[model samples]
Target: MLGIKHNQHTNLYARKCNMKKHLSALVLAVAMILSAISGVLAEDITTCTDSNGIVYQLSEDSSYLILKNAINTTGPLTVPSEIEYEGKLYTVKEIASKAFCGSTATTITLPSTLTYVGDMAFAYCPQLTKVSFGRSKVALGNRVFAGSPNLAGITNYSGVEKIGYGVFDGTEWLRTKSISTVDSAVYLGKVLVAYFGNASSFNISTSCTSIAPNAFNGNTTLTSIDLSNVKSVGSSAFEDCINLSSVTFGNSLVEIGSYAFDGCSSLGGEITLSDTCEKLGAFAFSKTSVETADLSKTKIESIGNGTFKNCDYLNSVILPESTKHIGNYSFQGDSFLSDINAQNVLTIGYDAFRDCSILSDKEYFENVESVLSGAFDGTIIYEDVNGSALVIGKTLYKTEETEINLAVADGVKSISPYAFYAAETAQLLALPTSLESIDEKAFISLSDGTIFVFTKNEQVYSDLESLTSGTIYVPEGNTIENENVSVGYITGITITKNPVKTEYTYNENFDPTGIEIEVNTVLNGKESSYNISQIGYEPSYTYNFSASPIVTVSYCGYETTVITSIKFTSVPGDVNRDKNVTSDDILLLRKYIAGLVSEKEVDLIASDIDGTIGVNSDDLLLLRKVVAGLVSLK
Candidate 1:
């Protein structure tokens, strides 16, 4: 029995030892697997230096590698698209910032897989002369080749999209290539890199699709540029080109980068943009001399900050319906900018039109969702005679007076939003002929009994008709027929000057040769005049020599008559008072000359055959000769 118990204990101890051994083996295997994973992760995040002294590091996401630094690299360097390391293939996707800066590489070849070249990637590389980009499209960061004095050659950048500011500045390539007369400008494939020529005018190549930043910056000699085929203009492309007076933008142009034409003081005339242009960058035309900015044809949604700022000659700006915002200081300091049509604008930024002294249309901001501080600082404002109505620019902003006749000034072109909303007690509101538009809800608060008197402006009348439930009155014939409107000839007509010839014989037509008719009417409570012909004036009268006749002038359903004396007059040769000249008249003239009839009894003036002072024997002789048909009276 003791021997059997010993055997059982030995078996149990063996089983326990076997279990412990299995557990130890399992723990060792797990440690090895975790170590392998840790190694792999470390390797993925580590930097690698190749035999050629080029350094590279795995990207943050571990999908690709970035060429980090090539400072120790020498001779011609070729960056492969795929680099093999530890039996793994990784794509070289980017050239990191300053990767090749201060390197001794004489020539460099970039890989087709490269998507980005970071800022100053090849800067300060004095010995680097040539660079070849295998891929056409890449995002080039700022000053990529700046300070590379000997670098002069570049190839294959046609499809590049984003070019940072001063990419090729201070490079031998830009200095020599830009001044070369071969193309008159430095071009990186189809991209216009720079213009260093002395030409006063330049026409960009039709093949160029993009303009690099600072391409024409500070160029004093260039007066005009024709970019008819370019699609994009980079930031500061033409900044401070003070002498550049004319720029012909193409229909293909879609984007203008920030500060593109800033400080171009000589740029003048109307700026006509194509509908295809969708983006206008900040300070694009600031400090220019342009007279008008008619961007109504563009598809741009915003006017960027300082776009037309300090444009001394800019007088008019027509914003398109697509425009939703006006950025800060857009038209600020444009003293001559008197008006802008921004009916579709949703918001206006700070100082958008500040210091625009003549800007009068503050009504444009009435419906905007946001209007920042000082949007209209120095604009013109006018007050009515009674100080009840306030007008800004050509817009009637608001009125306070009630239960009285209100007449808007003649130059008020628009009625601002809610201009008359509080004037419910106003019985008569007269608008001038100069009114062009009435903003939404302009007359919403007016009562049904409030009468509106306005002249014939189709747009104003239509707008007013839609706003007010009150009665409208227009001049008789000038009325735009509408419901709840009264049309009566309140106009008056007066014959200011009668005809020069007032005397008329029997059965003669009354001539109005020298008639001066004045048609006067009350418009907006102010006396106004209309041309006689414009009022359809007609003159009507009957001729009667028996007494003074009345000449009546009719205009706009109004009539006025003028009375002038008309004396009875005889014919030149009627001596018998019978209105006939014959042998009897000659016998009567002879009797008058022979004293058979007194001078007063006969028609002495008529019997005078000659126009002498007195009728004597010469008159009788001429009368007898007249009877014989030998001679006639003078």
Candidate 2:
């Protein structure tokens, strides 16, 4: 019985040892499972070394592999599109940010499946000369290839929609690629990205609608441009094109963006704008060599700041009737501009005409309403009133210093050329009605002082037409018919004679229109009335008459004049003539805002009653306020 008990105990001990061994095996399996699951859940990044000794990370959730970094290599390296790790394959989709930043690689090829490239991924890679994308649909982050000025070309198979700003900001070589695969030109959508041909002169394709910003920037070899189909020229499009001498603009072109041709110093000769051009952005022609710019045909309403600043060789500027405001520094540093015609300009910004050294004292202020300080500098200025007036070649060059008011002698028929050039003293000047002509750029820099004219003869209107600032007084029977005849600027001119009423009737009510009348007036008290139309002196009168106008004659000795008047005979706020202040007026206001019509199309005085002095969106809002009972039209 003792032997049987010992054998049973031994069997029990064997069973216990077998249970411990099973427990150990079970624990080992659980630990292995937990470790494998944790590796997938917590440590998802799988590191692998490529054949080229480049380290790449493959994440389980990632659809593609990422190139983390590369080992030092002497030659070009191409990244594989697919990476296999632990029995899984991941397509290389993106190059991680800063993956190859400042790399010394001479050339690199992106994978075919790459869709995204992080910022600065390969930036500052000085030796990187060629970058060829295998696929077309790749997106680049900001500055992805910035600071790599040595890049010869970036060949792509497809177009990228979202290109970050400054992606090629400092890539100077991209501007002068003399050889391209497609007509030596690169395009991004409908815009011309760059011209890589060696041709000095280029004609844009008809299919191109616009030129991309910096498209041809820093292209010094380009001598001329022919843009017959482009609608808009982007900002900095031709900046620093030092050799560009000629430009043939397209008929469909409308807007010239800021700095479009900022530094084209060789573009000399006559420059004229077509009638379709409506806007000229700031610094559009800054630092150019344009000799003469005639904008008479353009419909541009505003001259942007620095539009012609530093145009050292610019000699003449002809502003059109559509111009309203002259922005600050528009003509600053134009040393040679001697003549300027800004007939419809209302507001002159500060430094608009500053630093025009040789620009004569010929002022064209026929319609100038406001003149800011420093508009004219670097020109001759007449300071003291005490000394005798100095006349050079019939031009009053300078005057002696004096504190009292000044006056020209009665027989002084003309103000000398450039007289009172850049004068900025607060002193009055008296003029005789006998003064006939004043040279250009005269009275340009005058102070806010009064100018008294002691003559009833209305022929003197031509002499005072260019007086921008300073009040002027004329006879009671004469009137200065100009937009600058404001309350503070001009006074004492009146029309004592009653105007003859005339009318023109139409089948349907129409917008107010201007009428031209050929007046037969006798000059020098002679019965024979000369036709001045042959001499370009065609007087036109505008009237809202209900019937055909009847000719009215008047005799003024040297010249006879025909005059008539027709009034709208409507309330102040009735812009649309519906007899009510409604939304129609707002529509008209919007039309004016969109540059569809001018202030003369509507009631100018009433529209200006919004207290803004000009017809703009503010006046529209004020009229809307009146309609909403938020404010009064009065």
Global lDDT of each candidate = 0.72, 0.63
Model 2: per-residue lDDT, tens digit, 269-308? 9888788889898999999999999888889999999999
Q: Give the poorly placed runs of model 2, Cα more than 4 Å off.
A: 1-180, 361-363, 380-634
Cα misplacement distance, residue 475 of candidate 1 (Å): 54
Local lDDT at 450 for model 1: 38
Per-residue error (Å), model 2, residue 265: 1.5
Task: Give the per-residue lDDT digits (tens) of candidate 1, residues 26-63.
Answer: 76577678878887421222565554556778888878
Q: What's model 1's overall lDDT? A: 0.72
Q: In model 2, what is the error at residue 227, expressed in angstroms?
A: 1.1
